[model samples]
Structure formats: structure tokens, C-alpha cells
Target: MPESATAAPPLQVSSETAPLRQVVVHTPGEEMALVAPGNKDELLFDDLLFVEEAREEHATLVRLFEAAIGDAGAEGGAVLQLSDLLREAFDGADARESFVEALVELLPERNFEAYEAELKALGPDALHRFALTGQAPFAVSATPLPNLLFTRDLSAVVGDHPILSLAATAARRPESAIIRTIYHHHPRFAAARERLIELPEDVTFEGGDLLVVNERVVMIGQSERTSLGGVLAVARALLDRTSVEHVLMVNLPKERYCMHLDTVFTFADDDTCVVFPPIIEEPRDHVLHIEAGAERGGDGPREFRMRPLPSVREALEEVTGRSYTFIPCGGADPIRQRREQWTDGANLFAVRPGLVVGYARNRATYEALARAGFHVVSADDFLGFYGDAAAASQDRIAVRLSGNELSRGRGGPRCMTMPLVRMRNSES
Candidate 1:
């Protein structure tokens, strides 16, 4: 039997609003040191970050995920670190040897024997540290992966399949390989990673630009980080391999403020979405919809119907049979809207059907959410509520986390997280 017909992966993601089950995260490490006082933009970071402060901020985000446990206490959600995954992959001797060989081949020195000896002498944790943060002069100086913590840039999970992207920027290229390695070699994911969408090297895609709103629909953005070719490739893959029938292609401006789709647009709940007015409302975004077409004669290739779409909301309404509420990122002020959108005000990671996590600094954005019936609570308060049996509950809420250091890297909650599993709901 083909690999696609094999045992299903241990995870599934049908919608953006489902309860998150398992996720992969990478914290900022010494690789961040690659950016100095100058040319930070060359590496894709907006500002310098203190490693300790970023780590502390990440812990608070993790607390929100910890509290998102599903129906069973063990099923809600759990955090998995890339370092830990790499360490687990290294436990298998053959995989370890293969990784070392690949590393040596990629390096200019090609000191295979010396590299092998040093790697073998270190423990698993040291191996991750060595590979990621300590490979300064040789492996990652020029191509430092400071943005690896933005795990959402490399992959997007649709149902039981994970589509791995080829990053548009060279700075983020290595992250895809590292994640592919983990999925290929790690025991936990070995069987689960059966179906995948991997585009050609020339095509570029990123998770922040791809959103699986529901099982039958996916939205791929053409932005500074994701190309039109990338969207076509992923759209074809979804049509061929999964239950996805319609693919929405939204063209975003090639600018820094709207770098990714999630930067300017994200689903707030089942019936609402947070968006920058300039992109989703002003008609600046060029839209298209794609679906499978009739097959040709024998020995001929499959065809697709790609046509212009009036707006993404039209198809979404047809799919869900409901009208959506669009909340502006920075309220009604255009100046504040432009400024807040640059800070990732629209990027919110959903914890459940009506719950999400967002940056605390976007005051106007949170104010909009508040007016939309979203109870905005600090990360500490939410965590405290999780520990209390008598805590009052609301219909929906946004657990805000301190994002001073994190936002400096130019990504928000949804950009930092890569959800591997989201428990299925009745509607899902």
C-alpha cells in the first residue's frame, strides 16, 4: 500500500478555531547573537532582543497552551520544543550519523572526522545546542536562523497532513530543513508525517501566509514572504491529496508592514476575523479561488479552474453559511491602524472555538476585541483561572501576554506557534 493509505498521523487540524492539542515551538537561542548593532534587517529582525527576556515572555505564552487542555486532562494541548525533538531524533544511531554527515557535507571545512568525534562526545542536549546556537563561525554565521523561533514560518498542518514550506528569504531557509529532519527521524512523528506538500526550491511559502480555516477550505496569501508560485503549488497539493476543495488566494502588498497574511489577517472566532482595513476592506488585496477541473484523456495531466474571486468572505460565507464580523486591527483611526498593523496586531492564535492569545501591547486592537464581546484577560489572570474551579467564565476571551521582546522580532502569537493537532469539533 502507498504511504498515504498507512496509519493516520497522531494529530489532526480541521479548523483554526478548534482546541489545540499538540504544538512545536522553538525559543530564541544564541543564534540570535548573529545580528549585531548594524544590518539587523538583513537577517529579518526589526530590533535586537535580550535572549533572557524573550525566553521569559515565551514561558507566559506556554502557560496559556498548558491551560488549553482538551476534554481529557491529557488531551487538551502540550508544548513540544524543537530542541527536544532533535535530541529524540539523535537517539537513533543511523539518524544521528546521517545528520552529522549532512552537516559536514554542508560545511566548507568538511571536517567530517573531527565533527563526528565532537558530536559523539556530547549529550543529546548539547547536540541541539551545538547544531543550533553554537555553530557560529562555520555553520550559521552568514545564514543565522534568528527567526527559527517563529515556527509558523515553515509548516502548516491541514487535517492529518503537514505542508512544509520553502521560505522566501534565505535567512529562513534552513528552518525548513531542520523541521523536515525532525519529522523524518523523530520517532513520535515518523509515522505521522505520511502526507506532505513540499514545493520546488524556486517556490516560496510560509505558515503565516497559509491558514486552514476549515477542512474543505484553505487560504494561501501572496505576500512579501509567499510567492504566487508557492500558493499554486500548495493549492494543487491540497486538491490532489486532501479533502480541501476550494483554495482562496489573497494577494497582499509587497511591503514590510504586511509581510505575511497573519500579520494583516487572522480568524478571531468561528464567525469573526480580525483584519487590517487596508488589506481586507479597501479592495487592495487581489483575490482568486481555485478548485479541481475535469481530467483529460489517458496519459494527460489533471486541470484546475483558477478564477478571480470577489472577496474571500464570499466563499467563506458559502462554506459556513453565515455572515462574518470583521474587526479592524487598530479600531477606526487610520494612523493607528497602520502603526498597529506593523506590530502584528492581527496575529492571534486561537486556543478554542472562541478563545485566543494575542500581544498585550496592541491597545487599540484589544479594545476592538473587547467591544466584540471578547473578554481580554492578562496571561497571569488566565493561568490563575485555569487553576481555580470556581473561576467565572465568559463566552469568549483573549489571554494577553507581554510581548515587548517578542514583538521586537516582528511576529506575534500565531507566528510563533505551529499547531500540530487541534481536536475536532462537531462542526469540524
Candidate 2:
């Protein structure tokens, strides 16, 4: 008899080729309603209303992603769905049973058998609600996932490896489990041999605070969501896999607005970044860097480096081997910077080297982008360009989208987009 066939591994993304390629997204479902007006803050949400409308708007984004990738079913041009991935992982009865057992172990205090029964009883749509709201068929309290829209903050890919994130809050722990299951068992991703960087159970690491600057260097924020131990776990994991020269640990404010690194800063291009000067440039004096791997220690991990707030521009230059222009999130004005950063102004997503997607409400930020030689275009305009081969050839553009309602969810384009496969230089 022949041996059983195995699933293919997930495609590794190394560089940004076209503006955007292969993204993972989650369409809003029943779990979204768990964001009640009273407890919105607890979930890091600014406002709570219209889950259906949000789903509709998210659909537009899904369409946009499918169109940009060209062929929805192709490996390099696919939109991976969170729900679908979960369903795939839970396909086999044995897998489902094992996963439920693991989940019960993770949340030992909870009624495992009851929770498993509730999850099993739920239909496709209802499963989303049960997972998000945390309300089982029994008397369990509602624990809906109001922050699932900010998928970017849940997990991230560093170099050729993917890290299953451990969020700072207990509220988002379910999401971590969901992502871990998907990456571990999903047919497409299971083959990557991806390893999960396990942090101390109490330690937290949010994807929003972690940025993979390159294959060898990463920037992590020591903020409210990401603890020092969490950062160390990531550093050690990277070092174990390859020679990681330096892990720049940035200390950010523990305020609501400065919750994550992407909230205050994001790469606009391979050579440029958007930032809020107050946090990235003049951060409070409690920052440090740890050297890892062979060169730093004799065949072991080492940490003997510390630095004052490292300049974002300087770090980018060192990581990418190129000077970067810093575009203020809210332009040159201090007031605008604070105001816009509060609404995720700097959290722009790069589709290609010079092209990006951001909120249109941040007018000053777009103006700054224009001043820096980016051809600012609306999301509709970019989508139109994608429809027209003649216009798609144009370069150096920033696609703006109406993110008033979406931004209220506390994330911008980058938060909404989870890149799966970036085009290689040869392909581009």
C-alpha cells in the first residue's frame, strides 16, 4: 500500500515586490457583536456599532485583495480566510478532538467538556459567535472577540518563519489559539515546518509591536502589550534559527494610543518609514537592546547591549542598508501628530516598495507623502488601475481609502492586511 499524502507548505515571503500580494483576512461575523458599547475599551475598541456594515466594508477589502492578486485560487495570489482556515483545521474528528483538548488545557479553569460541546454544536456562522463572545451553550459569560478586525496584531511572519503570537490581554487569547491551529494543521501552511516561539505563559507579545525589519534584524516595542520577556523569546527564537545580529528593543509609552509599534510607526517603503517623533525619537529613557547568537556569545544567546531611544530612521538604515526619510504620522505639527496617531495615522501598509495603503482621513499625512514624492491615489483609483493594465504599470503611489469607520476600530490599512506572500525580486 502507498503512504498517505501530506499537505503542501506555506509559501515563504521574503521581499515586497508588487504593492500588495497574498493577504490573510477575516470577514466580520457573529463574534463582532461582542463589542458592546460598555466594554469596548476593555477590548481596545474606540466605538461599537454596525457589525453588519463593517462586514460589508470588509467584503470590499476582500474583493480588492482578490482583484489585486489576480487569481484567487493560486498559491501566490490567494486571500486566506481565518474562518476557512479554522474549518480546515477542525475537519477531521480526531484533529477537532485534539484541538479542543489543547484549548481546554490552556484554559484549565474553564469547563472544558462544556466549552468543547458548545463549540461543536455551533454551525459555521454560530461558531464565530461562540468563539468571539465566549458565550457557550451553558451559563458561561460572553467573551466575544471585538478586536479580530485588527488581525495584524494577532501574529506575524519574521524572515521565512512565522511566530504564533501570545497577546498581552487574556481577552485575545482565543485568537492566538485560532491562529496556532491554522498554521499548525492547515494543509497549505502545515508544510512550512514553522515553529512557534513559546513565551512564558504570563509574558505577552502582540504582533502590532513586532516588526520584521529584515531576515536578520527585528524591531520590537516594549510597550503595554509586549513585555521584555516576550521580546527576549522572539530574539532567542530568531537567533536559534539564524544569526540575528541585533534585536532593537524600543520602549514605547504605555498609553492607549501608543499601544503597539505599528500604531506609532510603520514602513512606508523599503527605504522610508512613517513615525510619531515624540514616541520613536524622544521615547522615555527606559530602552535597551540585546545581542543574540554566535557573534554576541560563545555559541549561546547574550544580552549586554543597551541604548537610548534608537532613531527609527537610523535603525531602518542599518537594517535595510539604505537611508530612510521619516514622514510624520500627522505631518510636522505636534497637535496633528497626536490627533492622527490616536486614529492609526502612521499604520500604513505597503503594497509594493514605494506604494502603500492608508486612511484618507489623515490628510496631513498624505500631504507629507506627496511632499516626499509619493503619487497619492485613492483605494478606488488603485483598484481601477489594477483593472486596467495600462494604468497598473505606474509607480510610486500611495492608495488612500475611506477608513473613518474602519479606523474607529483602532487600526488602519496595515492592521487590516496580513501579507501572506510578497513577490520576489525576480518575479517583480
Candidate 3:
């Protein structure tokens, strides 16, 4: 497909646990392989990952995602690939100039003339590959976007709105640039331009830090990947444009393993959440409750009511009406908790109310989930069993994908998924 020329349907994502209908993901390619062991730290990777193996793991996610949704072409939904969107944006109608201009704006002024000259000569197909691999058949120095495969960081789709995130590091800038361009020019999403909330400069909020609880509430984390300003900005925007009434700000420990909220927390059902106990149970952490001013105002001087929360657990319930059963990331053993948290054992992407996708390597976390009444199954089993329809064990299953090699890239299922649409409960 050249592009989603059919005017893809508008996206709607309100609850984290609603059935995941459509999502965006990127397969690891040359850019991912460019991260050498010596410079891995600079690229935010703990170790070098086997790109081929990681690509295979990502394929499983796409298959599982598509199977859960039933059909790719049905209801204007599909597992939209990031590279494919980039290709369409560069190759499709009147998209070249727009995409190039957006990309150049992110680069330094001195290099703009050179990049523009080189980018124009490459044609649409080369330009698409350039966006991912940062390489070309021709000559040019480009920023290696090693972390693009972890597509969850670029932007977020919140209740009919897409918020493009600003980058925290120079290496990750291309991720945002491509995401912004695709949403603005791609025929699938350009129509939502009016509803899009563009993040301000240096706010540095990634999607992993932004978690939607329900239409009435959103929870953004103050973690390594997201700043205080980012949380506040998103919280305010959600209140202004969406049905979100309050934003719960959970402060995380400044640690690599706890880089994002999902590294330590994620919803599994309406009344359950998988979490790393230390962060959620720590007394020293902060949880701020941000609400809009007494009256409603969109373009006027907005007033924000801020207060410190006694606890994020209780405050979240107040907003979503669910006293969630907290399932520890690892089992009760502290040693296992620290071990599993390092591998993002807490980061499980909820497919629906009680079904989810997680890494199979997190044995301790798996044990915890099993105890919490989740039927753990392999991705192969889930896909084979369901074929092309919803699973019979839909509400109480966890589809575990093998991530032995992919885990080296330092993200789990939720980190790799950028959910664009999720079905709202019919009863709601």
C-alpha cells in the first residue's frame, strides 16, 4: 500500500485495559544493529541486541495483536508498521516536502542545507529506509535512531487524540520527528490534525510514562524518561481536550530499571494491576493529583488545582472506581523482585479486561500472575488456538512471548507497543 488512502477511521484510546484494536510497532532493522557494544550506553541500551532475533520476537507481537483483533482490514484497523508509515509519508502524494521539512526542523540549522539536498535526491523508497536505518545508497551523515523499534516512546493516543512526545535525548529525536510527520501527513491520521496535542520543547515525556486509566483519569509517571514538566503538560492537555478529569502523577525512583512507569506498573484488568512492589509500596515516593480549575475553559486562562496525594493506589481508585488488586512483579522474594524488575517483568500490555501480553522469561512474575488467576500460555498456543478470532480464555489469559534476546534491548511488550485504538466496553 502506498498509504492508508482510504481515509482510515479516527482513533480512540481511553482505557488501558480495553480490548486493543489497533497499534503501531517497528521491527528492528539496520538502525537497531548500529548500536555497538561500546556506545550502547549512549544509546540507552544496556547491551547490544541481536537485531535478527529481536525482529523475530517483534513479529510474534504483531501476529498476536492482529489475531486478537480478528482481521487487519476489518473495521479500518491494522497493526500499522512504523517503517511502512514512513515509506508512505515519503512516497505518497505531496508528502515528500512536508516530511522533509519536519525532519530538517529537528536537525541543526548548519546541516539543514546538506540534509535537504541529500534527502531530496534519494526518492521516496530510499527516504523511507533512511528514516529507520539512517543510511542511504548515497552519502550523508544521519543520526542513528537506535531506539525507534521501541515504538511506545514517540507518542500516545488518548481518547480520540494523538499526543506526539518531545524527546529527552538527541539520539531519540528522529523517533518523534517521524511520528509527528506521519500523524500530520499520513492519510490514515492527518485528518486528526485538529485533535492532535503536540508536545512542547524539552518536555521529554515518552509514551511508556503516559498510561490512561479511563476516560475520566490518566496517570503519567515522573520517571527517567519523563520529566515533571512533561507530566504536568500532558495532564493539563488531557483535561483540556479529552474527558479526563484528573491526572495522577506517580514519582519513580531515579534508576535505570525503573526508567518508565511500565517498567514497574501496568493494568491487567479493571480491578488488577501488575507492579514492582518497592516503587508502589515505597513510602518516600510522591504522587501528585492534578485537576482542572473549578470552571471549564479551553482557550482561556486555565487554572490547575494541585495537591499531594496520600497514596497513588487509593487516589487511582478514587478516579477510576476500581480498588485494583495489586499483583507484585516478581514473587514475594525480594531477590526475585529485583531480578525480574530488571527484565521489565512488570511491563505487560493488557489486550483486554483480563488478558495481556508479557515476556515468557519473567518466571517469577509469571508465577505471581498464575497465582492471581491468570492462565499463562505461549504466544504460539494462543495464536494457534484462536486462529483468527478472540480467544476462549480471553478474560483470564496471559500470552507470553519469548524475549530472551529481545530483553537485551531493555523493554517488554508494553514498551514495544503503541496502541492507537482499543474498543471501549459496550456496557460502559
Candidate 4:
């Protein structure tokens, strides 16, 4: 198969809540069947998932994104599947070779190097299947990648540049490698190839810990999955390349519940955020502000300045020059807050300003949004009124999705989608 002759999609994501244009997602497949009680802990799954039901739920989420963005094919604003992109990227022999080489390195214990020739020679479709399910014509079997469902943790698009992830765990290394290979070989990402940010292998970084607050500010959490070294690495790259002025380094508790920044804090609108009270609102977590220092004429190495702030809210207000409103994840009850937070109550994905999507199981969280002036509705109701432009043009909306099986993996709407392009803050 030949690559598309048309131009690639615009890859610019400056803010979390801007009108979403293009995004990437993954629907559960055979790979999910590998997740069982025996290996659920090692695979980062809290419980088992009905793969079929999870796929149906994920499909609905994709449909909602398409409806929210309207004509996705127009201006390359469609919701893309990661598997489809991997298959497309495999069109070239170089891409196939690169992927096989990386896979060999990623699974050194499996001795995939021995079958490197056979792996590279396989068809694109077969290779794509094998990449995720670890099933091939050969006798050896690698563990299926179940965590691929959380596309947000793979990589992040910061401003116009795509910052790739060097995942922290061995279970997620292949996810990072696959995304990197796609960006390196896929024609869709050709235009932004030079601007891609590659971090050192020694440092660990994941997309879930990074957030583009606005055009001028980015926030990276130093958490269990993302290291301080990784935060500094990304901060320097953004400050030097883009128009960004500040990189807020948020320090989070190294716990399973607060594994990533998005798990505790996520933007709901231009000036509002859905937060897990314990980590985001309280002073338990520290916030560090990072910025580039004055330039020294010639080709000298760049320097940076750092300062500590009281909290994440204060850091955002100081850097973005705007006040922010925080909505608790589970209304006012402390018990409800902890319960809902565990199920990803605060991990909402904003399609547009004041329009967000999250798990419906978090009833208290939805009630909180309602109290905050948001027009709360079910995913079915939201989709029923899809054709009505006026229905989507409202000031604020909270679309609840059914996540009975999907939430078993400990991720929500934001964890499932990776935005590629978004309108500028002023225009949105």
C-alpha cells in the first residue's frame, strides 16, 4: 500500500480545554484477553475487564469525539485509532525494520532478535496484530500489551511539538516504542518530524503526567510514573523550542491512586478545573516553577531558573495571569471524594471550553458539575442531540459515559483519548 498523497493533519495542542480537532484512541481487542487475575497486578490493572463490553464503551467515546468535532475528515480532524496508524506506518520497509529492532531491544528476555528477520518480513497487518497481541507464526509468545487502552499515557502533543514518552515500567515500554516508531515513519506525522522531542532512555516520562495549561504554560507532575529528571528534560525542550514561558513542576504523592497528574487534576474550562481535593487543593503537594534564563549571545548552553510555589492553583494563577476555580471530584463529602477519586472522577476530557466527558459511575462528581452550572447529560442523550448545533453550543456541559468494564483498568475518558490538535485559546 502507498502513503496518502494529501497533506498531514495539523499537530498543535496548546491547551487542554480548547476545541478538540484531531485525537488518537485505542479500543480494546484480543490483547485485553491476556489480562487475568494471575497477571492483573503486573499489568497495572486493578481488576478484570470484559473485553467486548470495554470495546463497545470505547467505541461510544470515539463517536462522541467525532460528533463533538463535527466533520473529522475535513482538515484532518478525525478520531484516529492507534492500531490503524501502526498498520499504516508499517507500509514502509524501513518502518518495519525499525519496529522489529526496537521490539527486540524492548523484550530482551524473549530473544526476539533471533526471529528479527521473520518479524520484519511479516505483512503489515500481521505485524500490527503481533505487536499488540504478541501472537505470531513463530512458537515464542510475548505478553500482550493490555495497558495500550490508556492512549493518554503513550505520548503527548505539546504546542506544535510532539514530546515522546520513555515509559517508566517494562510493561509499558512497547507502547512508547510503537508510538515513537509511528511518529518516525508515518507519513501523517512527516511535517512535524523535526520538531519531535526525544528524551534520554535513563529518564522516565509519560503523557498522563504532562498537561499544556495554555499557550504559554505547561505543567509536568513528578510522580511515580514521571521522574524529576524527565520533568526537567521536557521543560528545557519546551522552553527552548516553543513560545511557552513557564513549566510548572507539580510534585504528587507516589501512590497508585495518584499515579499521574491527570488522575488528580484536569482542565474543565479556560479558568476551571476538576480536582481531587487531597492532592490538588491541599498543600500536601508542592509546585515548582521552571523558566529559561537570559540568553548568552553565542552558541553557549542554555540555563534555567527555578522557584517554589505554595500550590498548583497558585502556580497556575501566577504564570497564566488568571484566577482559577476548582470543582471537587466528589462534591462535598470526604468519603465520596475518596471513593469517586479512585474511579477516576477528576479524569475528565474536555472537548471544548466547559464541555467535558467522564465516567457516569461517578455520580457525586457529575452532581458537583451540575451545581457548578454545567448542563449534565448522559452520553446517549448527548449523542441523540448530536445533529443539533445549538445543543453543543451551550456554555457548559458534562457528558457522562457508561464505564462499568472500562473503569476496571483504572482510567477514564481523559486517559483513553490523546488530542493531536486543538484551536487556540482565544478562538476557542
Candidate 5:
């Protein structure tokens, strides 16, 4: 029998701080090695990564996640590599064809139509390798997808509905296409395929710009990577299809440093989030509230009412009926805040409420988290005590993972992971 026959459970991510059940990540591979100084800018990398160290750092993260979620025996642990899922999706003939066509469409400049048949005939492993490195046995070479390391930008699963991204730049277009194919073909996500929310080709939206505040509210950032149109498109779709009642759109500075929402903001607990003080505390970044209007029948346009909010904190409070604490990325230091936020200080991934993981280099950020009541611990230390009674008794943990090599890719923990299935607060 094929591997897809007994695929993992379907996806269900309703809140950012829920206990993570399953997630998708891509380890740095030859595609990352392909990124050199000369072509680094073109590949959307500020600096070329040392592939081996990056992989080691990412493995530490994977192990941390595995330890937190606990192993699930033969079905694999909580961490799922995007490449492995792609290979499994390729088990189906239809999935292979879909992937080939999507790749061909994504790279029309490559003129892949001529070799379409030959590409589809390749085995799953060969196809996976070709997709990553963009090198085929038949002498065909396309731009490698180095940005695949940041799985969070490809797609986001929000409350059982998968919102597929449309890459804003050509360099990351293949990453979007490949992930869309996985969501559509992977058996674990088969149920989501029916309710998948795909953005229009004319608009650009990366998953990193989105955050699920709760089952009824989602936050999207209109930044360098996600357009205003993309924000509205995703909002309208969520309002129409899912249980989401409010979509808070945050207009971010159109700069590389604030390219995605996760870069400046991420949830650390049910009522807390770490944020760049300049952006969230100051009134520079505008927050707009998009609420679902009266429901309409088939062929009728969905009604969505929009209004401006004082800030993200107010918006969440209004929607969730609860107060929230915004922990500064750097501990009360403006200079340190800028320096740490540049290295993705706010981009922490939550395993469960009060339990998060992020870059160890962000000392100021970790210090801020500690000041905010979180117990900061190194990845190694956390691993040492993990699964023990003492570890289980501790609360508000902030696990620091080494990210010196991985930070070159300009994405931290949240940006490197795409949570698929998560146990909701109520469920937990």
C-alpha cells in the first residue's frame, strides 16, 4: 500500500498559542547551498547561509518541537518536513501531474512545457530533488527555491481552512506553488482541499503576514510582502467560508525589516504577544478592522464592513473580550529593540500557551520575555528537563534555539514553521 493511504490526521489551527499537534518545516538543503554571494540578493537572502550549521540549528528546533509534543510512534512525530510530504503527495499520479503543471505555470520563462511529460515520469524522490534544486536529469535548470526553508510563507492553516499564498516576488513563486500542490495532494490535508482558500493571482499574500488570534479573529499585515489587496482577499474569504468574524489588517511599514507580520509580532500565550515596541506601541502602524456583514446566498457578494482601530491590542480586546499584554521585543531599550527585531526577535513559535521557542541570539528579547513572567531556558536545557515531572510543573517557558546560521535566512522560529494541527485552548 502507498504511504498516503494511512496519512496523518487533518489540519486544525484556530489559535496562535494552541498546543501544536503537527507542523510542516523544510530543513536547509542543497537549495540553500545554491545561494551564493553573487546571487544572494536575487534569491531573497540577505546573506548566504552555511547550509550545515543552518541544518544543525533547524534540527535542534525540530527536536525541541518533538520533545514538547511527544513522539507518535510509527506515524512520525509532530514535526513534518515539507519535502517528505511532497514526496508522499507525489505517490498519486494526479498529484504528480498537478505539481508538474503548477511548476510549469510558475516558470513560463523556463519553457517547461516541452519537457512536461518527462518531468512527470520521474520518480517521487527525483521529482522532490528537482523541485528543490531546480535541476533535472534532462539538462533543464530553473531557479532553485532557497526560500523554501521558511515554510511559514508558503501557506497558513487557519481553523481548518488552509489559506494558500501567492508569492509577492518571482524568487519565491516556486515555493508558493510547491506548497499549494502539497496542500491539495497530501492525504493528511485532503479534507482541507475542499475548503482551501486560494488568493487571486493578481494579488500577493505570504503566510508570514497572517496570524490567527482566535477561532473568530485573524490578523493580516499589509507590508512589503503582503499587499492591501491580498489582505482584503484573505479577509473576505475567511469571513465567507470559516468561523472568522473579524480580520484585523495591520498596515506595516513597506520595508525589508517589517516584511511580514510575524517579524514584528507573534503570540506567546493566550493573552500575551511579543512585539516590536516602535511598531505596536507607537501609532505609526495603522490597524483596520474588517468584520463580516450579513450573510448572502450563492452568487451574491459577501458583505464585509471595515473600520479603523486604535491598535492591535485594542482590536484583539474588542474581538476576544479580553485584555492582552504586549511584551516588547527588547527589554525597554530602543536601540536594542531595533537590533533584535532586525534578527526576528518577535518571531517566536508557541508549542502551547506560555510555552514558546525562538532565536537564542536575541538576548534582549529573551530578557524581555523573562521580565514578562516567562522562564527563559536554553534549547539544550529544555531538552534535558523535557518530559520530566519538574519540566511539566514549570509554566511560561521560553526555549531559546541557536540561530546564528539560520538567521541569515532572515526568519526565526515562527517564520520557519507552518503549524497544521493544533489543540485549541478549549480542547487543551
Candidate 6:
């Protein structure tokens, strides 16, 4: 078949395959070494270890995903590598210059000339090391990208547009740069350049904080990483470009565990989601809905406004046009909710409508999923099913991972895997 004949797929909203059409992932790199004992907190991680072993564990994840979703170069799906995407983005003179300029703007304290020269000379592997280590060759100082392993936190897709995230913390800025470069330059996504949205100024957003429940509705978390301004930027972009009717901005505590929306909530199916009860149920907590302007040329785009919504429960029901069952993470116990939420219990990745993946360490959360009628299975089990032709037809299964060490870095399975394509519901 001709390349042009291969039409781009339609966007889906489920974690099963929305926002994330093509994801750029970095297998754990030398950057993890920067998370020293005393600097763990500063790095936004709880502990540090060898990069080689981490890479090995991460490789298992990549293999499982490839087996399940298929590789980009192969038949079923696509997986865009960060290194390849970065190289493509830096291909042209204009793009390269623009990127270097952006990098300089981000790191004004450093000597631009030396930094540029050193980065230009490095190959992909060396560049990966440089980006992770934040090491400069000459007089310039480098800033380490410690959290790149949590790829889901860097950037996200809202509808068909890719929004470049501005992390709320300084520790994650390098990740933003890498993602920006990738989206700006990758050939696989060249068609999306005109649709790219960025908040290079005061706004801050993270993929972990934004959830595209559908083309018409998005769920945003007002947490440490995503700001009010960022939400507005995303809202404006969606309103201007798509038929998004509502942006549900959920206010989360700007604390350690509740750093992003995904830490406390994720979609399980079109009409169901997992949530932390305290925020979703508390009447005092602020949750608002910003309606998108009517279709372009209709009503001249309402002045990008926001209004307080009922409750998260009600808001989701209203937007989805159906009442959803809220499966509380950490079972029904408030104590378990607090404890497991801290370890990313609510952070689950949906591979298909009813199939999700998360950290197995959250035992209470797993039980809750089971209680909710989900067939909970370990990562190994899920991988086994995928590898077996006989079990491939099964639809409802949760892929659980041994995320004790990984989750200490403030993320879970959802934070790790980025889905590219999803099987759409024929009835929808």
C-alpha cells in the first residue's frame, strides 16, 4: 500500500488509546544515578540505584508493551523512541536553532555557546547521557532530567493536539525540553506541527495531570504540576480547535502524594473511573468546568470562561451522559486510601476499555478493582496471556507490576506506559 493511502487513525478517549497516539519513551538512563541518597527528595524520587538494572526492568516493560500493542515498525501499533524523535526534531537548521534558543532561554544561567557546541557534538547515546546528567563539557553547567522515566508526566495529547507540558517543579524541566523537541521535530509526527500547543511562559502542565475522557470532555487536575493558567491554555486551545464542550478541572491538594491528577484518579472505562474519595467527594474542594466556545463561527467563542461544577460524580455523569460507578482506590477504607494513594494506587493505565494496568504493590487497590468486577492479573500474567494466542481474545484483565522501587519515584504503571492506538467502540 502507498504511504499516503495509510490514513491516520481516529483519536479515541479511553486510556486504552486517546491523547497518546505516539509516545516518546526513554528507557531508564544514567540520569537515575543523579538521585543520590540525600538528593532523592530534590530529585522528586525516594531512592536511587544502578541505571543498568533499572534499564533492564524498564526493558521488560517495553517488551511487554511491544508484545501487546505491537511495534511502530511492525503491523499493529507504533512506539516512538525519544532518541529518534529528538534527532528528527533537530534535523533542520531552523528547528535546531529554535530548539537551541529555547534551551538557552530555559537555562539562562548557563553559557549558551559552550552548551550548544557540546550538545551538537554528542551522538544519541552520549546525548542521552548528557541530558540525564546535565553535564556540560566546558564552563556551562547542565541541569539533570531525573524524571524522564515517568514519560507520561512530560507531555500529553488533548483531542488531536499535542500540548507541551511545563512541569510545576524545576526538577522536571529537562523532560519538558526533551518532549518539546521531540514533538517539534519528529518526522512521524510532522503533520501535527501546526496543531502543537505550548505554554513557554508562566503556564505549567503535565501529562499526568490531564485526562482526555473524550473528544468533548477532558479531566484536568489542579495540582502541584498543573496550574490554573495551564488549564486555561489547554481549554483555549481545545475550544479554538475542536468540539470539546467541557474541561473538568479538578482541584487536588498541592502536596507530595497528590502532585498530579493521575496520582488520585484514572479512567477504567467510558462510564467508569477510579478516584480518591476525599477530593472527589468533598464539597468544599474546588472543581470547575470550563465550557469550550461553540463550534467555530458559532456564537463567536464564549470568552473562555469557567464555572463551578456540581461534584466530580455529577460532572462526570453530565458530561458522559451517564452515571458512572466510582471505584474508590484502596478499597472502601479511608486509611487504605490515604496509604495506597501515596504509592500511586489510583494511577492505572487502561490498555483497552476494560483492561487496565497498575502497580501490584497497591494490594488494597487491586482488591477494590476485583470488587468492581475487574479481572486483576499481575504483569507477568497479562504478558503470558498476550504471548499465548489462545488467551489473546480475552478482554477484561488488569496488568499488575512489581512497582515497589518504581513507585517510590512517585509514579505507577500508568505513569510509565504511553498508549498510541486503541480499538474504538463500534457503537459509539
In terms of lDDT, which candidate is strongest? 4
Q: After superposition, how far is residue 14 of candidate 5 from its true place, in Å?
A: 1.8
Worst 10 residues of 4 by lDDT: 1-10
Sort all candidates by TM-score, best to worst: 4, 5, 3, 1, 2, 6
Per residue, candidate 1 scores C-alpha lDDT tens digits across 1-428 of 22322223466788888777677788877787666667577778878998789999998887667666533222322777776677667666665666565555344343555656555556565666656754533343334578888999878888888888677775666566567667777766665667766677678888999888888988888999899889988898898889999888898989888889899889878779998988888883278878999878895656889888667677668656689999999898998898888888899888777787888888899999999999888998878766442122335887788999989999999999988878654533
Cα lDDT listed for each candidate: 0.76, 0.69, 0.81, 0.87, 0.86, 0.69
Clashes per model (N, Cα, C within 3 A): 2, 7, 0, 0, 0, 2
Residue 286 lDDT in candidate 3 = 82
For model 1, name the residue pairs that clash: 69-76, 70-76
Query: Which parts of model 1 have CA positions greater than 4 angstroms off?
Result: 1-9, 70-77, 97-127, 134-143, 388-394, 425-428
Off by over 4 Å in 5: 1-5, 71-76, 296-298, 388-394, 425-428
Tens digits of per-residue lDDT for model 5 on 1-428? 25544575767887998778888899989999988888888888999788899999999998888777764311445788888878888878888889889978877877888899999999888888888988778878577888998999999888888888899888888887788888888777766678889888789999999999889989999999999899999999998889898899998889999899999999999899999989887974399999987768888977888889898888889989999999999778899999999999999999888999999999999998888888999999988876543224438899999999999889999999998888753653
Name the lDDT value of residue 130 in candidate 6: 61
lDDT of 4 by residue, 1-428 (tens): 43442348768887998788888899999999988898888788889999889999998888888888775332544787888889888878899899989878766777888888898889888888888988888876577899999999988998889999888887888888799899999888889899999998779999999988988999999999999999999998999999889999999988889999999999999999999988888774399999999887898757999989998888899888899999999989989999999999999999988899999999999999999999999888888875546224756899999999999999999999888888744643
In model 5, the clashing pairs are none
Q: Using TM-score as the measure, name the better of candidate 2 and candidate 4.
A: 4
lDDT of 6 at 394: 43
Off by over 4 Å in 2: 1-9, 15-19, 71-77, 108-129, 284-287, 293-310, 388-394
* Model 3: CA > 4 A from native: 1-5, 71-74, 137-139, 295-299, 389-393, 425-428
| Count of clashing pairs, candidate 3 | 0
Give model 2 RMSD, 1 decimal: 3.8
Tens digits of per-residue lDDT for model 6 on 139-165?
556656768778888777655577788
Q: Given candidate 2, what's the lDDT at residue 228? A: 83
Q: Candidate 5: global Cα-lDDT? A: 0.86
